[model samples]
Target: MKIAASLIATLALAATTIAAPDNKHGNKPNKPIVINKKVLQTSKVPFIPHSGTALFTNWVGLNVDFKYVKPVFDLVNATKAYGNGTLISRGEAHITTIPPTEYDNILHPAGVTIEELNALAAKNNRLQRARFGLECLGRVQVVTKDGVFQQSVQIILKNYKDILSYRNDVFKLFVKKGGNPALFAADNFTPHITIGFKNRDIFIEDGVYKGKNACIHPIVAK
Candidate 1:
């Protein structure tokens, strides 16, 4: 609540700011348009409000195996199986190819960062590598009482520094502590839409694949 209130206040300040008028007009119009943060927020109230102390719950999201771009990969898998003579399908049907679209958000178009590329290059005997991370404005993953899993990764304004710091903290906490760790990532930041989730206790201190399912994405880079 405190954090949310603070953010709201900050946003309110920005909302109230008046843009300087252009001096090109000889009349020098001086009427300032005042913006009401409250009205703006109210207007956009239907959007998910993930910020604020009590409103957001953060967790260390973990996924051991992620079949990213599964739809595309599924097609490729079929081709490989057919070539290997395992599929044994010689049908006259043509392969209907669908051009990739933006629906698959896993493929990062921003490309790899210099730091990430360097990290991989520093390791010897690696021919190719891709390092990418996402700062989405959506809901974080959560587990329901019925064992169902949910995901939310909207295009929320992400804090890059905080995320990097969180990654480090996640590493140290999970690696060094070797016990139950607390995760407090988002705070009334905001929410857009529910993305997806693997819905499993990922960070098992003493389990295979670090106790995370391979199909889930990790809160921090693994």
Candidate 2:
């Protein structure tokens, strides 16, 4: 009787083991669940040439189409009562790829003339083919040519991978021509289009006037 009972107990134990839920193949503890996010499509803004003087003759930049940025200017102009500031003319809009100081200190010393640099940039077919996209509008305080702090409204650029890559290639070209790698160190380049400058006291947040002088309408890219 005892032997028979022991055999039955062992069989029951085996059945329980077989019936148990197998977690070895299940999700591991503390593992993060990844969600695939959808990429938003950006609207295309067309470019139209406008006649105006360059803000900095010594600075080199990629010219932006004025028609692409006219809406922002119009919005700011409509809300000029919020604060007094000068709007950047259509011709002044550009993405500054290289600053004036860098041209004088780095490229010139390395025997990389502006003409040669332009020729190299022109050869970059990717830049010519890529279309520009609007990212967002933001307000920042910038120093004017006269060395005074002025609040400026700027259009931050997006889909600018081609521009950034071109700048890196330009640096590499200079370095290949015997430029110092240490002097040509990477900079925190924020490619933006300055629309206008306003009084320091005026509060413009993310391209909109805020607080007492708030704008009635929000700035739209269209």
Candidate 3:
């Protein structure tokens, strides 16, 4: 009798797992409670791109030429922040725009989609599933073009990955211990960078997102 009960419980667990999203690989109905991985994220998110690629998220033409760029650069140069006289600030961050051929009309740039994400999981032999939520301003205004927009750029922060900060808001929402990417089951803190020419999505005063994303200033060289 006990053996029969154990078998029944196992079958029930297997059924539940099979109902979840199917993995990319061709696996026979996976067993239940199959998700056993964590999400990875980090704190101190990286900065935005330099002037060269900053236009990736902006529309065709917009007005976003920041005049203070030179002065700020001067201040950094005048300071002894660079002991070796090397300009490392430029290497801090970058935002490269994918060609339209990748993902044409999507609101945001080409990132790992649900399909690709699933495939990655299979390739890495991941069965447990989790999600992280983050966003990038879809468009921005260009100072030069007057009324152009830039494409949105957002990265999908997933589970079983390493995170910089284990205590972000999204991680708190789903993860318990903290935002440490190493212990993530599912997280939502998406470290993102957006390029906008004249986007109002950013909060100039408060210095945060007017809606769902944070403000990113791309300090590029002329």
The candidate that achieves the highest TM-score relative to the unseen native structure: 2
Superior candidate under TM-score, 1 versus 3:
3
lDDT for 66 (candidate 3): 27
Who is ahead in TM-score, 1 or 2?
2
- Model 3: residue 153 alpha-carbon error in angstroms: 4.1
Tens-digit per-residue lDDT, 1-222, candidate 1: 998777666544442331121235333113321212222122222212111222112112111111222321223223321111122111111100100121011111223122332232223312111112333212233333233332222212223343243344333433343422232222212211122223332111111121112222212212
Candidate 3, residue 192: the lDDT equals: 33
Give the residue spans of candidate 3 off by over 4 A. Answer: 1-160, 168-186, 202-222
TM-score for each predicted model, relative to the true structure = 0.17, 0.57, 0.18
Residue 99: error of model 1 in Å?
32
User: How close to the true structure is residue 88 of candidate 1, measured as C-alpha lDDT?
Assistant: 19
Candidates ranked by lDDT: 2, 3, 1
Tens digits of lDDT, candidate 2, 45-150:
2222222234324445666555545555665544443213354444345666666666777777898676665665555333344444555554544333333444
Off by over 4 Å in 1: 1-153, 156-159, 178-222
Candidate 2, position 74, lDDT: 60
Residue 147 accuracy (lDDT) in model 2: 36
Q: Count steric clashes of candidate 3.
A: 45
Residue-level lDDT for 46 in candidate 3: 23
Q: Could you tell me the TM-score of candidate 3?
A: 0.18
Q: Mind giving the per-residue lDDT tens digits that candidate 3 earns over 28-141?
A: 222221111211121212222212234333211111112222333333333331111322233122221222221122312323232332233233222212223332122111
